[model samples]
Target chain A: MTKFEIRGLRADVLIGAEERQEILKGVDLTINSGETHAIMGPNGSGKSTLAYAIAGHPKYEITDGEVLLDGENVLEMSVDERARAGLFLAMQYPVEVPGVSMSNFLRSAVTAVRGEAPKLRAFSKELQQAMGGLSIDPAFAARGVNEGFSGGEKKRHEILQLELLKPKVAILDETDSGLDVDALKVVSEGINRARATGEVGVMLITHYTRILQYVRPDRVHVFAHGQVAESGGPELADVLESEGYERFVKAGASQ
Target chain B: MASPNLGITEHSHGAGEIPISKLDTHGSFDVNDFPVPNGREEEWRFTPLRRLRGLHDGRDIADGVVKVDVQAPAEVSVETVARDDARLGTSFLPTDRVSALAYQAFTEATVVTVPADTTAAEPVFVRITGVRQGDAYGHVLVHVRRHAAATVVLEYSGTAVYADNVEFVVDDGARLDVVSLQDWERDAVQVSHQYTRVGRDARFRSFVVTLGGDLVRLSPKVGYTGPGGDAELHGLYFTGAGQHHEHRSLIDHNVSNTRSRVEYKGALSGEDAHAVWIGDVIIGEGTQGTDSYEHNRNLVLTDGTRVDSVPNLEIFTGEVEGAGHASASGRLDDIHLFYLQSRGIPADEARRLVIRGFFADLINRIEVPELRERIMAEVEEKLALHE
Candidate 1:
């Protein structure tokens, strides 16, 4: 099992030569391969920043932190180098690349991570299978990456990348936000399938326990005030879902 | 009262409200008729006058600087004839001064003729190269006979101060595709005008791809001889540091039942890299049932680069089928870069992918794989300079 560790991570948004606001104060977490950890939080809780800082996002300035994947420094790696180091981030809002098609984008990413371009025959077959697995339209292969795509389609596309890139540790940031019932099921099944391989670690971030009903997390983390306020098992999700995060927020505020 | 535009395809024309009336472009082809521009004229406003290299003033006409070579199939005939051969200026007169000077100064004109009803089995290729030559005037004429379908490519390269005139005539029922690539060396200065006439029920299409040159200013005009003519003009260009590339297009729809589409996409990087695109469509009297749409888009890759795009439409009567024009320019999308980098692709390669994707749609229309790959490789080379 590959061990992924975040020790005393802190970062800020480096927007256009100005690092004005800090997001992650100090975050600490660890996940091994074949494990699923869920990072749940309310809006403005800095959950997204945690994901971005760990992935070496340029916009995020990591003031004090260390993101280690199997004892390797991810913060010291470039964005693509971080990915090649077995770290993946499925962003809540996937950007639209106007000219590049989904097939080309996926192939490029696969080549970058694998250090070699995938064979045409194998790539084509694998792409088609992944599209089928994600319940994505076959026509999307030629369409521009996330261009003019609906919210649900974008979420499904993120999962499709997860199924293809096959990173050792995957950080899914709010993957369940905009998906409809059918799309949520399709996307959740995609996540579960990736985990079933037993070689990948899953970190699913969300606000509600809705997607948790489908892809159960082995560990549940309640995030507040830029760090984990509480951590427990799947039962913790039920408690947060039924009773709400009012107590957790108050408890975090008291600290 | 009802809306004039009820068709779903109306949206394809884009949304923006410019005057439905005409804006006259101030200059004519006659050497004496066009007054000397002091950077105040409508056409010369955006162009840097100092960079024109005296081609605008008829000061330099060094003819033998660039070598012209042609490789074509046997079914077609290539000839070098004088100005009064009765074949010159059959389609239209020059619309600008530099082109007129090129017409007046050139002693010999290269004419490639395709016989009527003969579909070409191979493309005609014209290669122009200059070895740091001083200055020159050039002219090219393409005559496609009735019902014939032919493709021609004019490849320009090397160094020179050049002005050129290229004319195309598509006879009745004939189809013509002309691709002009201005892949000049970094110090080349070129000004060119392309005039085309599409005959009854004929089709005309041209791809003007500009990849190099210090300053390249080209204007292409299209006119129809009869009804049912179709014209598609697609162009792509890239501007680097200290380079100025300007392209202007005019499609004339004076007859009934004709269609015209113009689309141009460009990118600019480096400090002071500039690009300009002007699209003008005039639906004159008797032009009923005319469908025309033109769009210009620019991607600014760096901080100091600038792009100016103007899309104009002049509709005479409401009897027209549909007409519209639109233009937009902006910087490289940040979200796009982040998305690609997050997926393990390096930032530099991701940027290239984004740019390559931008031109893939139009480049795919080239039909020939080798040519498409060749042009795209040059584009890749330009991106390497940045990332």
Candidate 2:
């Protein structure tokens, strides 16, 4: 089992050349392996900021915080180091990388993360199997990574990476936003398959409770004003679904 | 400025409002017809005149012979003829100062011919080595006769200041594939003009790869003599520190139902590394059903490097099928770098992968397998120098 903790995570984003705006303020969270946590928040609630800050995105400056992955200082590691340490961030908007085919990118990623390059025959079989599970076209293996992919196709590719890389802790940021009903089911199934291995922790961040219906979360945290307003079991998600985030926004304003 | 010299008559067509640029009417075979460029003309604006080693001016006249060695299949014919040979300049004329100077200075010319109704089983390799004894002038003519097919590779190496004009004459129903490689020594300077004439229903494909040299300028021009002719020009250049490599291509659609496509990609690294690509496509009046497009893309790998990419499209006829041009030069996309690094690839390896991918689309189009591999290896070597 692996324990990941973020304590007093205060961060700022550079809005201009010399301007900095504080986004995450004194946010705290802990996630353990094999447990899925649903971080529910409205717009500008610092959900994506928290995800990027933990993933070592250069855009976010961690002013005051400590992120510990199994008691190791995760903040000191570089972006690739964070990735090599078994942390993956499924970006809300994955950028298109032209000319680098999906097969080449996946092989490089797997080799870097796993410390050794997999045999070509074995890796091809594994990729074909994973892509089949997600219903992705086999031809995508030769096409440039995420180049000219539709909204739904891009989201599915993100999940495909998640299934192939097999990180210990995955922060899926808005993976189900642009997906259709059928794509959502396929993606959720892939997430569940990763979770079934009992070696990965899922931090599913979303504004809607629709995806929670498919992949049940062990914990639900209502994130507001860069802090957790309330925390509870799976029932909390249903409560938020019915009541909406109006109460949490008002409570955060008052605080 | 010169009244649209090729095909369009001024004020005679409805599309006569477009201004005629001086470059459209510049052509001559006499060295004295063209003035010495002071680096201000449109053709000489991006070039470094001082680095030319007098190839641009008359100081570097041809005094030493640049050895020309031709290797071809037994069926192909190779001949060395005097400057007065009738077939030397039958299909080409000097268009610029350097070309005119080289045309007036060379003592002999090398002509490689593929006879009519025959297909050469192997590519003809013309390897030119600079003697470095004195400035050199050279000329080569590649003739693909009627109903024939051939492939030619022109390889340049060694050190000296050299200027040459190469002509390609493709007859009716013939096809010619040519790859001109400028892999010179570190201190070499070369100015080359390659003019091609395609006959009725003929096809021409040319690849110009510039990888080494202190200063190298190449102008490749193509004109169709009859309808249904097609031409494709593809080029790749990697400019290292203090190196200047430029490619200018002009495609003149003088007849109807002709087609042309030009694509050039470049990468520059190190301080003072400069690359320039100029693509000019003109669809003349009455040349209906003309299809042409040119594109240029440059990848800047380091700071202090410069790239100038200019694409010009001039169409005097509104009846053409299509005509377009595009140019772009910039550093590698940071998001692409981040995307790769976020996947656990190291920063250096990520850069290598992105650069490799940037050139893969063009390199894969090269039909020669060995040359393609060598170009990739050379690209990797340049990337390593940057790192």
Name the top DockQ candidate.
2
lDDT (Cα, tens digit) per residue for candidate 1, span B1-387: 001221212212332432123323333446766666677556687899888878888775474478788989999899878877788876666655787787777767889999999988888998878775678877889999999999999999998888888889998999999888999999988899888888999999999999999999999988888899999999999899989999999888867888999999998889999999989897866468999999998988888998989887767667888898888898666667777988899988887887788877678779667789998889889988966
User: Candidate 1 — what's its lDDT?
Assistant: 0.85
Fnat for each model? 0.77, 0.59
> Global CA lDDT of candidate 2, please?
0.88
For A1-255, candidate 2 gives per-residue lDDT tens digits of 999898999999877789999999988899999999999988899999999889878788999979989999889998888889999889899988766888999999999999999999999999999999999999998888898898888888888889888898999999989888999999999999999999998999999999999999999998999888789999999998899999988887887
- Which is the leading candidate under lDDT? 2
User: What is the overall TM-score of model 2 with all chains considered together?
Assistant: 0.81
| A54-156: candidate 1 lDDT, tens digit per residue | 8876677889978889899888888888888888999888888776888989999999988999999999999999999888889999988998999899999
For model 1, report the TM-score of its A chain.
Answer: 0.96
TM-scores of the candidates in the order shown: 0.73, 0.81
